[model samples]
Structures are given as C-alpha cells and as structure tokens.
Target: MENKNRLLLYVHFNRNNQLSEHVLYQLQQLRHNFEEIYLISNSKLTDGDFVRLTDSKLADGFLQRENVGYDFAAWAEAMKHYGFDKLANYDSVTIMNDTCFGPVYDFSKTIEQMESDNQIDFWGITNNRSHKVKPWEDKEAIVLTDHIQSYFVSYKQKVVQSTTFQKFWSGIEILDDVVAVIIKYETAMTKYFEDAGFKSAVLFDTRKEDWTGMVVHDFSVFNLPELLRRKIPLLKIKAFSYGAEYLTTPLVVEQLKASTLYPIRLLIDHMTDVDYPDRAYMLGEKTLTFNHENTSNNLLKIAIHLHANHLEPIPEYFEYFNKYVQDYELYITTDSQEKKAAIEQTYPVSQLKSVILTESDEILSWWDVATKMEQYDLVGHFCTQRNEDKNWLFEEVQQREIKQVLLKPAQEIFQTFKEDSKLGLLVTDVPTFYQQFKTENLTADEIWGNMAQIWQKIEFRKDRDLKRLSNKSLKYATMVWYRPQALYNLLKIDIKKLAIDSGVLIDEFFPAFERLLIYVSWTSGYDFRVSPSLPKERLVLEQSDNQVPQVLGVDFEQIRLRKLLKELLRKVKKIITYRFKLKK
Candidate 1:
C-alpha cells in the first residue's frame, strides 16, 4: 500500500519522566517489527552514552532536539533535523506517540488497508462497528478540531515534506496573526488536497477515529482492554495493567473477537471520532444564525470579528444582516458605525440594544466580551488548531514565553478596577491592552468571565443547592501600572489625546495576533485567556456576574513597543505648528 518499506516510527522520547521508561520498553519490543527504528529524542540522542542506545537490536539511528534548537520551541527546531533523520529516505511517514498504537500485526498490512481506501489524509483510525452509533459524540474519541497535540498520528511523506509545520498551545503573542498564519497555510494545504476533491484538514489530519479515543468514558460502548486481550494478545493491555481491565469483561471481548479483523477494527475506532462530537464546536463563519433554541436570554449579541480590511469590504453588509437578526434582542459592539448601522439597519433594531463606543473599546478582544456579556456563543467562523509548529505567532515575536508573560498584567488590572468607581474613564499608558471593564450593564446573574468554569457554574448556577461555577477561581485584575509610570506620564505620551481624537482609528494588529493561542470566543467563564474580540459592552455583560466599568491593563511593555510604533501625537502637533508658523 505504501510506496516504501522504511516505516519511520517517529517518537520524541524525553528521559524526563514516567513516559520515557514506558516508551523504551515499547521501542525495544517493537523495533524488530519495523525495518529500521528511528527516534527523535529531547534527551541526549548523540551523547556517547545515548549513542549506546543506538546499538540496541531495535533502534538503528537516533535524532536529538538539542542538535537543532534554532531558538524556537524544542519541537519546531527539531523538525528540520528529524527531516534529515528518516523523512527524506521514507515515502510513507507514520507519526504517532508511544501512547498511540494499534494492532501489533503486520504494519505493512495496515498501510495497505489505508491506501487501498484512497485516503492519503487517512491520518487517524476508525472503529468499524456493527451496531448503531451515537452521532454527536464523535470528537470525544479523537478530535482534529481546535488543536492537535501529538498523542497519535500517521502521515504520508507528502504531508511531512511539503508543509511547513508549526506547534503552539493556547497562548501566544499577536494571536490573530499567528492564527492567520496557521489558517493560511493549513487551509492552503487542505485546499490543495480538497481541490482534487479529497478531504483533508490542510496540514491537519481530518481523519477521525471511530470513537475518537481509545479510553471511552462509559458513554461510548467502546469496550475495554479485557475485551481486547484475546483479540490483541500482545496488546500490552494498558487499561487492565493499570487496573482498568474491568472495562473489557468477557462479553465485550466476545463481541469484539467476533469481527473478521479482530485487532484492527478496535484500533480504527480508537483513532476516529466516528461518534461523540460537538463537545464544544468551533465558531462558524456565518455572521448570523437564526436561533432555533430560544429562551428569554436577552442581552446583546456582539459580532466577534477576527479581521479588518483597511478598505471596507462591505458598504452595507449589516443592512443584509440586520434584516435577519432584528427579531431577537441583541447589542452590537464592533468598531465601525457605518458597519454597525448598516448591520443594525439590516436587522430589526426595535429589540436591538446599545453599541459599545468604537473609540474606547479596541477591537482586539473576545476575552472581554465573554467576560462582560451576559450570554453568547460563537455561531460561526469556527477555527482549526494543530500543534505550535504550525501555529502562526511562533513565526513572528517567536517566543512561547513572551506570549505567556503579557497576561499577568491583564489579569491584575481587571481585578483592581470596580464598576462603581465611575471613574468616567481610566487610562493606561499601555496602548492596546486596557485592563478596565465597564460594568454599567451587567445583570444579576452575570459574574466575571475571568473566573474558572467551576466558578461560573457555582456563581451562575440556577440550582441554589450546588454552588459549582461560583466557588471556582475568581481573580480580579487591578491597575498595576500608573504607579510605575503614573497616569500623567500616560497622557504626556498622548494616549488621552488619542482617546479624545474623534476619528481615532483602532489599530489593525489586535485580531491578527490572537490566533497563536487556541483562541475561541468566550462562552464559559473558564475560557478566558488571550481574547479574540476585545471586551465589547454586551460580551462583557454576558461574561460578568455584575456589569460594571473596570480598568483595562497591559504591561508597560506595550507602551514601550508603542513608543517605537510611531511619532508621539504631541511631537506631531509641535512639528505641524512649527511648519505652519514658519510658513507665515
């Protein structure tokens, strides 16, 4: 089935902990099954002692991360080196972790089955079942959705050689740009395969396992390891050895063995999400969805936008949108009035409510709206996530840690400001990131979206008996700046004038930067991290337990980046005044 016999069994073994020993036993036992076992290690793969590891009857060569550390994540930098290790010589690349395994039988047969099916994107496995299946729960098995952290994966040589790989977790700088980068590349790859009319997730693997995961949570009748032991005796039954054998009692084993392809069927099910999905769906691109699920959950529906065209794309896109959304109540919190009004006119606004001030609210945050708003869901423009190597922001500011550092101040500033302060407006020297949230419109059930999901459940739980979402971690971000540079220094930097300036344009970079984080719109309080759309009045109210105006914070680092951004407004003023005076 595969064009080549050299199956590159890729695993990045870290001598770091419990996982390493398990991986070693796995490699030593399975190396004979593969032609030449190759490994990429975070450990010292080349050290003389480690070199001895290569002498093993199983491992032929070893690749190490440190050899290729190009100042990015250990993973991203390692790819180029490992590409040298075996990917070049190999045509069919099967990528999987030790945790990700299937039938022990001929790996060649498995490749044959995959290719005979004509799925070059057959990156994951699926369970072939005889019984009826649950439709919605597919992703619980194996999701290729939000982000693919390597657990188990397989790819063709083309996927590995052709695409530029990136990896990132939930946080990174300039997320939109990072996300745009990831989407742009992945979409391109997926489209290339797609235009040929084969389904692929760009560089992402769209193939789903039958049950999505091997460890099915009682919900899926996905039988246990006991059921598997007979079918796959070399099964190294992890579930049972770890005291989980009860999941596969005799009856389930009998049912599983009944299949013609005993071990393979089970493995396939474990890889694909043939069932259990929509666990938390990605937001759709469709701007408006007519709600079929209805309650008097009225507040405002904000358009959590991910992009801005320097030139207007729609003269009156909203006019078309307003006609559909007007019946249900909602508030609009975007940056453009022409856009907002055109949208408002499109939908019936008799029930529509307030619009957030385009000036004060920079359009760079979904965290704010989810925290501030009373109710919301990302209806469209759903995104896909892969590991950090494919993530975009890693392309620019390029450090994973720097993206993490920015949030500390954001959380602090939010905690300090209370809505009652009525501080008509609080200013931060930090240009784009404001820690304050205006709380005038919060409802009785609204709680800070910044709190953990458990807290949101406890705080907002209608059931008085269980204080679930409320008791979770609720932190207040306070104004940590002003003291360092003082508020006056901020005005002198010209932020106050910028805020006052009627035609002040929202910067274009905010949305472009957030995609590096696995960003989705805020629904549960626990979901707040790097925000996609800035805190719009409605989304904040939806996220808030009580609506109030509060401080927006950013590390003075942003202020520093801004000083380098452009000439100071005051400096520009002086330059213009001098030029005019000289002209006289």
Candidate 2:
C-alpha cells in the first residue's frame, strides 16, 4: 500500500518572521506520508526550523529565497528542479503549502481511498467555487469546475508525467504579486489538467455539503463530524481572513470540538503573530503571555464601593469576592458605618478582608475609595448605581465578569493582565442592550469637549495615540476593572468640579469620563478590551490538563443555553408587566 514514488513539495511562507509551531506541526503530519519531501520557503526560515526540517529523514532537499511569486512560484521552482525530468519515477506528487492547518485527524485512510480509485487523476483536500459567483448573484451560477483548491493537491502518476503538467508549470512566469500568481497559476491549474482529460476529486467538496454557501468559506465547524468521518485533512487558515471576528468564540470552540481539531486554536492564540492578532484575542484565545507567578502577586485589588442608605446587601457579591481571595485583595468600602456593621453581621468577619469607612454621604465618597485603590496594580470598582430592585444588584454584579465568568480561574485573570502590558483596563461587556444608552448614536465631540484639560494631565507614552476614542464609545453603569495609573489623568480632576445637580454638563461629565476611561488606556500606551466571554481555548486546555471538575457535569453549552433562556424569559416578563401597567 506504500507509494514508493510519492514526493511532496511543501511551499511555506514565514509570514510571522519565525517558523511557527503550527506550521511545523503541519509539516510533521505530512512528512511521514511521502517518500520524498522538498521543504521550500518564500522567506528565510529560522536556523532552528531549517535544521529541524532538514534533519527529517523524509526531506529530499530545501529551497529558501526572498518571497516573490507566493506558493505558485515556490512550487514551480521545485518542480523544475525535481519534478520536470523525473516524473516517470514518481507515482504521485503532492503540491502543498502551509496555507492551512490540520491533519488533526489522520489523512492516510483518505489518501488510501483516493489511491484505490484510479478514476481520480488528480485530487485535493477540499474545493470551493465562490470565485465564479457573480457580484450581484448570491449563489454561484455555474458548477465549480476548479475541482481542487490550490492549498493542497496531488497528481496521479499519469497526470504528473504528462506533458501538460510539465508545460503548464514550466511556463509559469515569476510574478512578484501574489494576486497575479493566483490568477496566472493557482486558478489556471485545474483548467490545464482537466483540458488534458484528467478527472479530479476533493475529499470535502463544498458543492456536496448541504450547509449554506457562506459556511463553505469557513472551516464549517458546525459540519465537523461529517468532515472528520470523511477523513478530510487540512483546514484553510486564510478562509477566516475577513470574518474571524464575526464568528463567535463559543461557536469556534464547538467547531473545534466537533472537528476534533487542535492546531487552528493554537493559531488563534498566536494570531497577533500572524495578521489578525486582535481578532484572535477577541475571539477568546490567550494571545498574550507573561511571568504568571509575578503577575499573580500583583493581581488587581477589588473594592466594592457602596454609599448604602437603606438597601439590603447583595450577599452573593461577598461569596464571589471570597472565592478569588488568593488572587485579589477585596475591600468593602462604604460611607455608612451602619451598612458596614450590617454586612459584617451577615458575612463572617474572617471573609470580609477590610471594611473602610469614607464618613461622607456625598457622591464624591467614591473618590476616597479610588484613592485607597491607587497604590494597587489595578482596582475593580464594584458599586451599585441602582438600588430600588434587588434583582438589579444581582444582575449587575453577575455581569461583573463577562459571559461565562465561571470559566476564568482567578490565577488566569491575573495572568491576562501581566501578559499584555498594554491592557490597562478590562471592562465587563457593556449592558448596553437597555434603551437608555444608544451607543451607536454617541460621537466623540459629544462625549469630550471641555474634558481635554483633564486628559492632558496624565503623562501618556509618546508612541501611543488616542484619536480612536473620538469615534468609538461605550455604555454601562460604571463598574470597571481598571489600572489606577491608566485612569490617573481622569481621577486627578478635582472631585468638587465633578459634582453637579443635573444638566447637559453634568450628563456630559460622567459619561465623558466613561469615554475618557477608554481613551486614557490607549493614550497612555495601554490597551483595553471589552472583557471577553469565556475563552474556548482556555477551557479546552484545562480539560486536556485534567483540571476540570468532571463530577460537576458543567456543560458549557447547556449553561450558555440556560442563561440565554432565562434572559429571554426575563425580557418577556418585563414586556408583560409594562403592558399590564399600561392597561391599568
């Protein structure tokens, strides 16, 4: 069953300036399947990677040069040297590049299936035809004849030895642009082979899938079981080019689990090393790394700031705070001594780290709490802006963490801050769904007019700019996990100046601070991200490491679904209550 004459030419581009672990992993998966392997790079491979590749017993040779004609050029260069005159000796030749990630599941069975069928003169991992679709048309009008995507394709001995194969590759002009190369060589590859009467097959042809056409462009994680069952190998990494962000993190995880795939998530983690690092980070991967122990020691201090008058304390907040005491110092700061005494009576004194009294009833009492928080690495201000409803405190406090907050281990939370020096603030995803704040309508000029004086005080790192704040804005009742230094500029403003009865200026001031909070993070050479939902990769990693509590039956999907249903029911109840009041 072993194909003695199979040769693989792996064309790689070192886009990250280093040979990536994902690429190496892909190569390792491929190298053993072929008798002879030529590892070619469009850019200089790192010494370590080059040595590792060359050391492989399967590697016949390597070609490294400046990036010119993309994968097409790399393929042609190798073909001229090894494939042109020696095609008769080879049974099959695979032209592949590190444009995808996988063989997460083995492809030997799939390869065997294709080899057994002599009808397949040429074959590939997957095929797409959206290129033929007209701009106005939503679906492709013609059958996608380009039976194989250029990412990975194998030619049978008859096709490889034919004049058409040699002539087509020999005529390949060394184009400097990748787009031109794709048009001239990659797209034209199928036409040349087919015209010469060669039949082709793809392991996972998009035309065969029942899923919508848009799904074809993605790894189609939802269709993973079928793809794996078919033994399809390799997932197109570039397929996520424009829309990685649009794909929700949970769905991505589900797809990964369904596919039984691993490397793509790793790619997502180090995506910044690639082109879309920010998108990868947002899509719930740990795109940052740091000294974990050091970071944990300096974890953000948490303070529950309250100006209690007569509201019953949220005991759940204390339970949540106590759970992460090893990672964070919790402070219960209130203006009312009576409120502090009541809270202490409800919770054991041992659990309540420190209850500081500001001794003031004014709104500016938070400034005293803020001052107390300044000495720490970061501070989380958990204060209740609404007091009438107990459910409001529970809902708001529960949102203190992002969606699926249970997924984050306290140590990992501290590690996230340490890993990204630029991440100065982490705000829980804004509860902006409420009608009061239409974030889409707010603009920069509206948010910050006279606030420039307050902003100018904080010394920002010279390299960073805050121009983006003028466009992007956020909304939430102010509960934030913030770096005190990141907000040093806004906090330095006189507390007396900030207090007002209620007007456009008063409205502008606090909301402007919310907007300013985002800008100062960026301007001060620090960054802010809407604290993400549970990171899928983190959960998977924990599972793999056996850190998960198996006894709990903690199904993430079930938990997410339950939460969603609860939200829906809550909305329905609110609607019904409003209607009942209107009728009355």
Candidate 3:
C-alpha cells in the first residue's frame, strides 16, 4: 500500500494574515510526508502576502479577479484545470482551508487507509447546530463529492470525470457552487469510486476519533514546524511535558483565565523573556517567538480553571438571612462544549434551551421573555462582584436615571436629614452622593481612589470618638462608618456608649425634641425655640469610627432619642382617638 505520489493541496484563504502564514509554515513541515504539493490560492493578495509550498512540486494557482462574483467564477475554472493537472501529476490528491489545515500523513506508506469502505466523503469539525432540531438533521460534515471544500483527497480519474467538477467550472452560482458541490458530490464520489473498483472515505471534522481510526497520529500541520504545535495540537499530555517551569502567581492566575474566555485575552501583551507566556508566544533562551496558529480553542482548559473560583449561585447572597443554599442551573446561549464545561464546573448550570436574543435597534430598546417553569423553586438575578452585578439588578428594575434626576433624590434625603428631628443613625459604606460632591475634572479612576481615602479618614475619626465614650461609659450619637477599619474602630467603645451604626441621619435631633416636649409639659412653657444639637446644649456622642467627626448632640449618632420626643405626638394621637370615641 506504499503509494508514492503528490498531494495536490489547495487552499482558498480570506484575509487570514499571520494566522495563514503560520499555517503555511505548518504545511511546510508536512511536505516531508507528501511526495509533492500543488497549492492553488483563490483570493485577493496584498503586499508581502504569501503562501509557501515546500514539496518542490509547488504550483501556486491564482484567479483572474478580486470581485467575489468574478473571482469565484475564475477560481472554479482554475480548480477544474488544477484538479486535472494534480491528477495527471500525482496519484493521490488533497485540498484544505484557511481556518486550519494539516496533519500531513505518511500517505506513501498508508495510502491504502483511504480505501476503507467505512470512511465518509466529507469530514468536518462540527458540534450540535440548533437548539431544537436533531443534530443529524442539522448540518454536519459529509465525506463525498459534495461538501468536499475544507479538506478532501481523491484519485485522479475521479477528479477528471466528476459531474460536480464540470458544474463547478460552468461559472453559474460560483459562490454557492463551493457549498453545493460538497453536499452533492460526497455521495457521487463515493459511488463512482466504488463502481470504478477503488474505495476511499472522509475523516469527518478532523476529530481525534477520525484520526484514531486512520492511525495517522504523528502528522504535521503540513510544513510549518513551529505552527505544528498550534494547527494540529500535540496531545494534551505532550503540552504539559514541555521543558519549562510554570510561573504561577496569584495575580497572573485570574488574568490568564479571563484573558482566554472573554475578549480581554487580546489585551495581554505577550512578553519575550517571561516564563509560561500566553498561548500566543514563547520566549526562550534568546528567541522571542509568536505562533500565528492562535485559536480560541487553544485555551479551553485555562478558561475552565479561572471561572470555577468566582462562580456562586445567583441566590448565594441571600444565604445570611435565609438559610438553604443549594446548587442551581443556568441555560447558556452558546453550543460550545468547551465553554459549557467551563461554566458548569465553576457555576451551577440550568438546563434550558437558548432563547433567541433580540438585539436592540432604533425601533425597540427593550426585550423580555418570561415563562412559568416550576422546575426551579424561584427566579432571581445573577450577580458578579464587578459592576455587572449592580447592572443586573438595575436591568431587572428597569430604572434609568440621569445624573440630574438622581441628584434630586439625593438632595432631598440630605436636606430632610439635616432639618428633621425624628430620625436616628446612619451607617453606610460610602455616601451615595459622594460622586456629585467631588471636585470636577477628576478622572473616574481618581474619583474612586479619592473616595477610598475619604472613607479611610472617616473611619479614623469614628475610632477616636468611640474610645472617648468608653472612657466615661457614656453613649455617643448614632454611628456611621463604611470601611473595614471603620468597623474595627467603632468596637473601641461599649455598645451602650456607642451609636448603633445603623444607616440613618438627623437622629440626634429627635431625642432633643422629645426632651423639650417633656420639659414644656412639666412647666407651662409658651414661646419655645431650640438650637440644633447645638454645642453647650450638646450631648457627647461616640462615632462608630475614629476618623468620623465628633458632633454636638444633634449629630448622626442618637439611636432612639426620637421615640422619647414622639411622646408629644403620642398625646396628639390620644386626643384624636378620644375625639373619635366620643363621636362614635
């Protein structure tokens, strides 16, 4: 079965750039296995754009035009002529594609392998296509005269007399011809070849299973030595065996994972002298190199590793108050098994088919699809610590507020807290209106840093205030501090002397007002005007954090003073109730 002949390799590439070049090199490495090669490129070429054929029998074929309609017709004619020439030159023939190509086999030794009856006509790398249709009903690779576009190999006579070949050369629907020929000719080629008393089949989708059956494991990406590692991946174990040290650190771990799954992988600038650079490059002793055979499929495992750590259920946060934490599921949109594995191990997965996403356009800005499925106990939002979490909550709420509109609500709260007396305590992470109060012309990054600094200072003051209260065993006005340090500082004083650290404002004023109503009741008081938690008339209150400013009686920290003041309101309510009773 040792058949020595050329593999008339043809590739019709689009604007693949570096990826194409690297694959070409991979093909060069594969040249050693092929007796000769004939490459026919049918596309527009740019300056310095090139494809190299190393098997000495390189015949670079070109089309006549750049226009798709015109170029396609010319390419079809060229393919017919080239197919004939390839048949006349080499006993065996093959064709490839721009996205990927290779696994140049020992055709001279195992040419008989193509003669197997079990082999298919068109081999393609495909997954399940649609959400509902049976996978077989959806498009998959066919190995015959039809669907032979991406990769195909056949005998010379079959190519010369092909009806599909004649129709392709006729120049009608040339673009569609590329697609249709693969579908139509797959069966035709299989039947014709068998009738002529030769057997051949397709290796569908270049999957490992297909290659295993053929027993062609140690093949190249054709010729590119370096790109061999990319276009045709070395076995996963082989990658782990490369003589290198993995420089794993905390920071690089997350970035490495996210860089692969999300588009951010493109942002990482590959360093020449670094150990374990991204999949894109390898910087060795003296050479800094990049492999153009970069594919997203190249980093599947890395992505899975990264997502596993941060994934918690959408309802994980509700755990503190409502016990019961169970695994949940997510119905994702993509059909990629690699991505599905990454998401599933890291996060709970829901088993729902993907719903069609209606992208926003000028006519419609919102879309919603709802169904009552009892499979899940409850429906809620999923959140990420990143801004995405907040956005998810707001997206469901459907509340869009401009900066001006948001300011109105903030101002109202600030003013009411300033004037009102019945409220108590305020404890929050940071002021909601901190952004509005900052100096203008600051960048977003600087604004965040500044806010952190301000909060730090508040925490320090709160600490000092608490220690003061604890010394005398006297309680302070309501406490409010947002940072971790602020919480620690508040603990300096006893809870009895410290403010509740609850989120409320103007609370101190309430207690003062209540005290006044009681005093007035005891005396026959008439004209009463009181100062706001004024010093001298002030009560000493310990703040939750040392950095928070100490205030006179009317400051934030007065927890239930408003209830005593409300004694006056209680009398009014009693009067109303008595009047109603009398009327009744």
Candidate 4:
C-alpha cells in the first residue's frame, strides 16, 4: 500500500472580518488528517485576525477573497490559486466549510473509515434524496435531484485531476444570489462528476428512510442526536442558529456539553456574532422566578426611581415594594408641588430619600435622575399614570406590567441577579395583546425608525449586532429591574435634548427607549431574561390561545363598534377618491 497524502481546503466567513474560536478549533482538530491545510476566507481579515491566523500555524497557506459568492466560490478560488497540476500531487482533497460545530468525536476515525473504502472516487458526510418539488422555488414545481451536501466533501485524486473538475472550477462565476449558487454549484457538483463516470458515497446516507419516519431530508437539522449516536463527526450549526420546528436547542446544547469535549463557548460566540435574536432565549437560562425565598442578601445597593404624576397608586406601590424589597433608597418626582405634597402626606416621608418637583414629563424626570444611577448596583424605574382613555385593552396591559414588575418579591429578583453576573435586565414578558398584534400594530416601521434614531445618540459597544438590536423584544411600558452599569450609555444621554431635537413623538420615545434598553445591556456584555408573573411555559401557552383572557374584561360590543367605524371610514375614503377622480 502507498503512503496516502491528503489536502484540506477550509472555507470560512465572519461578518466582522475576524477569525472565530470555533473555526480555529475546527482547524486544530482537522490539521492532522491532511498533509497540508489551506484556509480560504470570503471576508478580508483584520490585521489582528490575520496575525492570529498566522500565529496558529494550522494552515499551510491562506487566501482572502471578496464575500460575493458563498462557500463554493471560496473553494473554487482556492482551486484556481493552487492550480489542478499542483493539486494532483495529493491522494485526496477535502473541502469543508465553517457551517458546522464539529467533529464532536474524533475526526481521525471517520477519515480512516472513508479512506479504507477506495471503491468511491469522491465522498461527503451526508447526502440528500431527490425531492418531488424544489424547496426554494415556489412559483414553479421543479424536482430536485439527489446530491451530496457540499458542507464536508472529499475528492479522490482521480476526480481532482479530471478535466471535468478543472472545467467546473474554471466556469465558477460571481453569483450574487445565494439560492442560484446553491443550485448551480452545491447541488450540481455531485451529478456533474457522476455523469463523468465518477462514483460517490456519503458517510450517513439520507436517501434511505429510517425508523423515525422523519420526512425532513436534512438529517443534520432534525436527526442530530441520532447522527451523533451513529458517530457522525460534525453537527450542523444551523440546527441551533436557524432552529428546527420540533427541536429544542437547550436539550441539544446540554447533550453536546455532556457528551463531547468540543468547546461550547465557541458555538455561543459564533451565534452571538451572527446576531441570532433567540440566542438568549434558546441558550441562556429561560426564566428567573421571583417566588423563591431569598437565601442570601449579598448587600447589593438598590435604588427605585418613581415618577408619581398621579398620587392614587403611590400608597399601593409603596406597600408592594416594602413587602418585597429587602432594602432600597427611593427617589420621587412629581409634576407639581401640590401633587408632591399629597404624596408626602399619604406615604411615609421618612423612607423617601428625595422628592423633586419637575414641570416636564417623565422623560425629563428620567434624565434628571441619570446622574444618581452610578450610586446603585440595581435600579428600577416606575411611573404612575392615570389612563384617560376608557380603553379596556390599554388598562389591562398597564395592570399586567405593574403586577409583573412591582408585585414580584424584590429580594428573590436581587438574588437571581447575584447568581448570574451577566444577567443585566429583568423584565416582564411581552403582553399577550401585544404579542398577538405584534406584526399588525407593534412592529411598525415608525417604531423601528424611532429606535434607530435613539440608538444613534448612544456610544454603544462596537461588537454588538445592530440587526439583532433592531429585532429585540422590549418592555413596552418601560417598567424594568436592571443593572445600572448595563444602562450606563443610555442613562448618560440628555433626554431633554433628544426629545426636542430628535423629532420623535414623546410617546414614541418611551417605547423606543424601552426596546433599546435590551440592546444596550447586550452591548455592555450582559444578558437579559424574562421574569413573568406566570411560569414562562404557561405564559407561552396562554398567549398562544386564540380566546381573549377573561382578566382583560374586554367588551365585545366596543370591538364591534370600532370595526364598524373602520369599515365606514374605508367606504367614505373610497367615495371621496371617486368624486376627486371625476373632478380631475
């Protein structure tokens, strides 16, 4: 038997143009399998990243190209640079991408097994069966043929030296559309080589149906545990990043942690960098409860800032805090001296640290208290407002916000904060009404635009993903328990100037600020979790129900009347448009 020499070309991409730990870990594991390894990146590497790549010494060579064409383009560019004549010196060549989080087990065993089977000219880790209809194409029902998945594919010298392979690499063009690239390169490559009289095989074939009777062709996405059980080396990163319908990411994460020596933090870092919005929801501790007994105080400094515009809720709010919070300093702001006096008369004045009279709205009051935030480790903001509208939905949401934030025992919440150093903001879940109407009412372009304007004012951390920040779930009512340091950048901003010059509506500013709070915390290297009155699971189920909650006490007649008015307005607009057209 001849001594076999193998070459590996690893394709990588990072939006920040920095090399990630996972990619490095992958190369470190695979370095031994190949005689020489080359790293081909779509992103132009930063100076620091280039230095680190050179220092690692895992790759024999490196190539950086424009990020126009996905993994296939990177591979093609590598081939073009190396040339077919030079590549023919190796017995086998493996082309892999950074789209997965493995070799969960050892890479050597899988490589040995594949190398022993010399019958196949080329091979891949997985293969897809022919589809009745193409997945990406909706307008036309086109059939998709069976092909080897392009993520981790190896070619024997015969396939590599063949004119067909050389021609395929030569014909590679810059494709802007990802779907087109997938169709032309990834899906077509296997068939193209097969038509040239080359045999192909997959380590874990998806062409045959299994006992699970799972229809999903991508075993990497759905049958990950089974794949791992069968000692399939790689785990697809998309299983956790994009998420599968029936999959629970946390379970998979736990399995990976318990079973494999693979560094889990690498996966976390990659997900965070990509700005996957559900990263926290799927990976971090799900819900922090307020019902648990406080075991230790740890003496964390706490401050509560109350904007008591209306004095009606002052006494009740104080009672809730007194019962729940172990200790805290209080700051009160009122719109008038008369209202301040009334609050002082009704509530215990001795407990109040300071009572300031402010002529401006709550936004200005928030700005005035910003300087005092540094003194406290944990700070909470609450505002008292009397709803002028007799709208039941608005009242219901307001009550829910108050209950979730204030009614929960503060000692337990503080203890939770102490336990998780990274826990930045403890907020109530999105109101059921808002969640139901999120697409229609809550996620307006105006809201996102307002958030963007506010975000521009702050000196946010550079590494934070702006796209993820835009899609963050917010505490709409602006009631939250948060670490003061997490909100430092936001609190430093002069709210009065923002209110006047930003051209954002006073109402809009509050909601936008609330949304940006989560992002600010994230940028400050912190994570947030929901502390709902109900268990998060139960809350989700309740929210999913189509029936309106009885607690909302909504009047069906009012809804019907509103619907009628909308319909009437539409008819009037149509009539006006017809008359205006005739006049024109």
Measured against the true structure, the TM-scores of the candidates, in listed sequence, are: 0.29, 0.57, 0.29, 0.62
- Candidate 2, residues 1-584: lDDT per residue as tens digits? 47556889888786546677787777677666788888888877778776776675536788887787778877888887875768557888889888776777667777888877978999887765544533234544432345467888888888877888888888888787665566566667787788889998887777545665345443433344455566566655554443453424435445665766565555553443443323432323432322223223544554444444433435545555555434455566566778778766765655356766764432355566667667777666665344356556545544554322421344555566776675677654334233222324444565555345445544654433334223233345256566787777556666445334222444455555655666666555465655433332332111111122111124657767897999999999999999999999
For TM-score, the strongest prediction is 4
Cα error, residue 209 of model 3, in Å, equals 10
lDDT of 1 by residue, 355-381 (tens): 443432333323223333324321111
lDDT tens digits, residue span 1-584, model 4:
23359999999887767787888888888877887889888987777877777787788898978887888888888988988999988899889998888888887877787777878999998888777655465567666679999999999988888888889888998898898888778888899999999999998887875737454767877676678777788888776654522334555666777888987767765665565433433423345556556444647988898888878777767876776774788999998889888877767655688888984567668877878877888888887756666664575466646655544557777877888787788777656555454322444466677777777788876655455233545445367788888888888987657767977556667656766776788788676766654454444311112232221224546877997999999999999999999999
Pairs of colliding residues, candidate 4? none
Tens digits of per-residue lDDT for model 3, 1-584: 34356454555544322224334544554555456554445555543444333322334443324434333343355566665544545554554443332232223233344433234332222211111212244676443322222344444435445554444445345444444543344224444444645443443332232233221222222112222223222111122213122222212223333432322212221111111221211111111112222122211010000111123432333231122112222333222355445554554434333322322220010112122112332222122222256455542321122111111122232233334332112211112222113312323333233223222333342121111111211111111101112122222322222223422232332232212221121121111111112122222222222223332223233534665568879999999999999999
**Could you give the C-alpha RMSD of every candidate to the true structure, in order shown?**
26.5, 10.4, 30.2, 10.0
Cα lDDT for residue 398, model 2?
A: 47
What does candidate 1 score on TM? 0.29
lDDT of each: 0.32, 0.59, 0.30, 0.73
User: What is the alpha-carbon lDDT of model 1 when measured against the actual structure?
Assistant: 0.32
lDDT for 357 (candidate 4): 90
Which candidate ranks first by lDDT, i.e. highest? 4
Error of 1 at 148 (Å): 8.5
How well does candidate 2 score on lDDT at residue 261? 51
